[model samples]
Target: MNAPAASSHLLPAVAPRPVPQVLLDALSARFGPKQYSVAQAVREQHGRDESSFDVPPPVAVVFAESTEDVADAVRLAAAHAVPVIPFGSGSSLEGHLLAVQGGISLDVSRMNRLLRLDADDLTVTVQPGLTRKQLNEQIKDSGLFFPIDPGADASLGGMVATRASGTNAVRYGTMRENVLALEVVTASGETLRTGTRARKSSAGYDLTRLIVGSEGTLAVVTEVTLRLYPLPEAVSAAVCSFPSIEAAVRTTIQTIQMGVPIARCELIDVNTVRMVNRHSNLTLPESPMLLMEFHGSPTGVAEQAGTVQEIAADHGGKGFEWATTPEERTRLWTARHNAYFAAVQSRPGCRAVATDTCVPISRLADCLLDSVQEADASGIPYFLVGHVGDGNFHFGYLIDPNSAEERATAEALSDALVARALALEGTCTGEHGIGLHKMGFLVDEAGAGGVEMMRTLKRALDPLNILNPGKIFVL
Candidate 1:
């Protein structure tokens, strides 16, 4: 069967750039037969991500074990002007890993290592391939932990590339704030360092911020130095169910406005609560729910919870359950993190077209309620979840991949939702970067002139246009 037509937000079909045999031979010689793979399985694995797009896989996969390995592989790809798509844990949702202009998939999962740790400064430097869970596990005993959790146990490199934020972002901020430094492999195969371990700098260019959310278009991040946080003395997790999403959202807005330092405030609508209940084996109240966490001294946490409980009470929130034990807290959060998978499993053989939009705290209710009404009217099976404390949320519209009609309907819903977000002075994407899925929305969010400015930077850094080509606005 012919593939479904590209959505208005997706890149049109493009021929994959030819990968010359010499480049493959060179890579094989350098990395050996085991490390360099032309096998279909490896290429297929590296070629796609959680996105709905079905673009062809890259020509080959090159496993890089070190920064030297990444630099060498990139240099070889540069020599032939071949697109080099960096592969992390393969959890990105925006088709970021697709090889639209086929070349090589540079797998950095083997480069996983903790390079440096400075508990005194609350900073640590790690290789790009190290996952967030692994990093936290390694540093758990140090009294310091990295708090940027983007749903997936994503690689630090991938998290840095996408400027990801998650449940903890309501207080700790996203990668843009936490990522202090980077060692990047430039398009020309040269290694370059940006930022420093210092908390703040008045240095030139601020290349660290530039590369943090560049989506691998500017360069491949080899190492990331991140700001860490000390584990809180007392931590508490709680869930409160509301009669409606509006009630839950209003409570959240009030909490944030009243200056409550909520570590995580996530919203799971009734449908998603049911899915999570089934998937995670929990008997959560099947209603619009807020999963929240508080971090501080025991008294401080109690005070914060009491204030929020009163606010929730005003909004008709009830069944405020607390999971104070570590195991219970883990189970609740694990279910929250597994929401996407739970949703996916709820509908077998379906592809999800997820929408990520964030509005101002005051405008969230307006933006979200209208979108919810439209989604309910559309008759698509979906799950609603959000880091609502910061005005960001996602709706995963599950559709049968084989049905062109379903794909078009899902795209229409996403497009209208994005237009609504932009109209409310919000971004089309809060965390998921502009990969193949949101090219048009990028132009809508950042005007043509702004996009051109991005293209200018892309050209200057990657003149050959070989680094993750056809992403973050066509260059």
Candidate 2:
């Protein structure tokens, strides 16, 4: 069964909600003139992300420098009952950071400061503006690293907001496991801290978990303390091809089930492979392939990878080649990380709808097979790539934004995939949070009661419903 779209949808404001002259004066007094931008040029720039959804620009844009700045911005917006959308890197695919309500877009990109690094504790404190790449570069020489690699160079705040996990999730786990604590500013302009930097916790309430995936719906993340891992001693990577996707997926299931402790096991369908090939200037065969990576002592990693190769052989996987050189491994991952862009560029003048689902390892084979069948039969354009180690895969569908028929067809395919995922005891969304794109499908996946509970929490934390209004649950 499918859930209906929003009832009586109200269009979002194109400009910031009309503010009184007196309030504007107050804002100018609180911060310098350059700190706030009410002009159309600024509002329009911060309003939209890479979402396929309509770009309803924010009413105003604020360059917040500190936690106090965020608090003041949220307070002022709430006073006028205006939405305060937190803007990060603007690379969100799910309409996560879009300013649909047209209020103040509080951009923290300027707060790119690395505060502290406790090598002993294996944790780092950073501002919301710090991107993962920047953070790692700052701490690389220290021999410690943050491992939640979301492919996109998304901001730590944005990643935490969306609960993002990427290629390394199968090895190091998702943002849920990496974020040790968060400093957030509530909708009421009050600041509070959630979680501690402790390695383990049996806390009364896991507020960290609540805010991590809340997608800026409850509070604005100002700072974060994240768990880190020591640099791996040894690493090995390879790109191996298979005659078919089923063979690749089956081999992945076996490798994981046999407990090879693989670090990365990503499945790239042949169509995606073709895209990557053209984009990267490689001449790989147009066959499904699995990108494998292992990290450990040299002997241990080599032995484990060989065992996985044997498992692949059993499933008829071939073309396994070692990317043993650091340069080769980096090049391989760089291509893989650019898969989404490559898929989009494969068809110019189109937007990509990246819909993904997760299934139990037991049913992963059948679930992936079903997805392949649906894509082939629907006449819709989609290519598959995923962290098969965790039974999570992303289906990229490049659709023309202008055609109603195309949009409808693509949407129908998304619904079908979501249904299939739920049927296989998986989730409608694996890593991406429920933003504007997936709200319509939430009822089918999480049920009305589950959604209501989500709304209840949103209302409890943000009674005014100003922080990212109309994001997750039906408001």
Candidate 3:
């Protein structure tokens, strides 16, 4: 399956703005040749991300090592009215990193450094370029870890931009809840700080959160202060096989309603389980399964697991497998994290049109089952997985990009799924932001008046429309 061409109508009709030679020369002189690059390889690398959209690469890449460097680059770009797309780890699944309107990619990977760590206060401030895994490793010695893990080893800036949530979201919440403060570079190249280390405040605008999920359309994030958690004293993981996806989902709904406080509760349908088994070399039961984790005191962990096991049994869940050792737990999660890759590999030369819809926990089963039926009937190969505890799930519709019919079918399936989610009072995207794919859906979800308000805010902050132009919405 070859990658399909993205619909031109879905993208804004904005031509790539040319990068003037004088602007390039100034950037090269300001940052030195080593940090400024126009090499085809560098620009191409910074252009696309995990998204399937095939847009042209940026004309140049600026490797900014400090907040001042970012300010300078933005200042130069502002002068030229060239779009500036902030680049982090480039792991965003949406078209967040695409240089739709050509300009310079402000690469901030060089700005990764731990600026401050308040171990006692359970807070840490770091450069935006730091990856979540790197943040955990650096703070592990202090017995604290960041909980927002969006599967990919995504940079903190990227995660914040997407307001990412993962398996742990049921317990720890998303970036919207974990983030404390932000140091952002405005469209005019001025530094603005929001939020504080204190737990909460009756601040004026809550600008920290405004930038948390703005998708780089509002401003560029340079520094982030995040809330951290102390490692649990007791931890255990388990996998339970179910007769059907409904059973697994019902078990999860019951567990959450009962207030189990499960650290992680994920659902992988039988098809996805097979893919994981083949990819990870583990013979998990080739059935709908729930992979769960519990964290607390030893007694509390045991109690929670017992309650969940009982709920699973009531729903015909059996073959409960336990992974207590750290090695065993890691193996289980690594396989779960690799589910997307496994599904993609299952269909050679295929691109996945992944769907992210989240509803209230009570409505999870309805939203998932109906979508599953539609997908199965469409005859498109897909994999189903969800953080069911929080009513968020993804369906990866694998399609041959060369087949226009297949692409349309997959997209139709996605459209139906989003409509269903909305009818059930859910969102079109659970974690992924409205980059290039879901612009219309954002309108559908947020309504015309709400989207207009967002546009108002965008015009107020970035009147020049030079920051990540042609994203979130059309000007």
**TM-score per model over all chains:** 0.98, 0.94, 0.97
lDDT of 3 by residue, 232-346 (tens): 9999999999999998999999999998999999999988989988888888889999999999999999999999999999999999888888898998786689999999999
- The candidates, ranked best first by lDDT, are 1, 3, 2
Between prediction 1 and prediction 2, the one with superior TM-score is 1
In model 3, where do residues sit more than 4 Å from their true spots? 1-9
RMSD of each: 2.5, 2.5, 2.6
The 10 consecutive residues of candidate 3 with the worst lDDT sum are 1-10
- Best TM-score among the predictions, by candidate number: 1
lDDT of 2 by residue, 332-365 (tens): 7765787888888988888877777888988898
Q: List the residue pairs that clash in candidate 2.
A: 15-59, 16-59
Count of clashes in candidate 3: 4
Q: In candidate 3, which residue pairs clash?
A: 1-349, 2-401, 3-401, 4-401
lDDT against the true structure, per candidate, is: 0.92, 0.83, 0.90
Residue runs of model 1 more than 4 Å from their true location after superposition: 1-7
Model 2 off-target regions past 4 Å?
1-25, 39-41
